[model samples]
Target: ARRHALRDGVAIVPAAMPSQANVVSLRMPLALYGIAGIDEIHDSVIEAQAISKGDGIKGRAHHVVDSQGASRIGRYGWKADIATLKDMVANAFANELGIT
Candidate 1:
């Protein structure tokens, strides 16, 4: 993919999710990482803020629900309450490659 992007004269930037290991390194409790199901999405939003707070990352971290006011979290891939920018990029890739 890098080669194809280079050959096509396109700029490529890969966004990375903060790994479980990294999240753990922030010194949050184990239970924090265990929150995963859709019901825990709101909890994850709070967790993000707490983790970022622990890590001293500035700015707020909160879930932005869609027009329907639903917090989806990990439902469609990626973390947070809704489809992230990375989700959109990956969906575009899937569409282009007809992956599903």
Candidate 2:
């Protein structure tokens, strides 16, 4: 595949089947790792502001920011960093293949 890709400029490789749950972006400081189902997508939004406060081994069941930056709800991808689906696709493409 490598040789073919190098010579032919492209090669198709099958990917492993995916599971229902997948990783998406989180707003950072309170990262949401994996989402199981579409139904559970907005479940975090309502509580995106609550967290465990105080010092030492601090962990938030969820996270919140003081003045705000990104919002609690994101649709396109995890952390909802990219503003559009197109941006997400481009970023994923670049990161995966190291080709921007």
Best by lDDT: 1
> Model 1: per-residue lDDT, tens digit, 1-96?
335646687776777876753532343422423333444345466556555456557543445554345553333433443444445445646864
Can you give the lDDT of residue 36 in candidate 2?
30
Q: On residues 1-100, what C-alpha lDDT tens digit does candidate 2 reach at each position?
A: 3355457767677787578758576543323345234324453643453344454434333332212354433334565444334444566679754787
| Prediction 1 global C-alpha lDDT | 0.48
Q: TM-score for every candidate vs. truth?
A: 0.24, 0.26
C-alpha lDDT values of all predictions: 0.48, 0.46
Off by over 4 Å in 1: 1-38, 41-48, 51-55, 70-76, 79-100
Whole-model alpha-carbon lDDT for candidate 2? 0.46
Clashing pairs in 1: 73-81
Q: Which ten residues in a row have the lowest lDDT in candidate 1?
A: 27-36
Q: Tell me the number of clashing residue pairs for each predicted model.
A: 1, 4
Q: Which stretches of candidate 2 lie over 4 Å from their true place?
A: 1-74
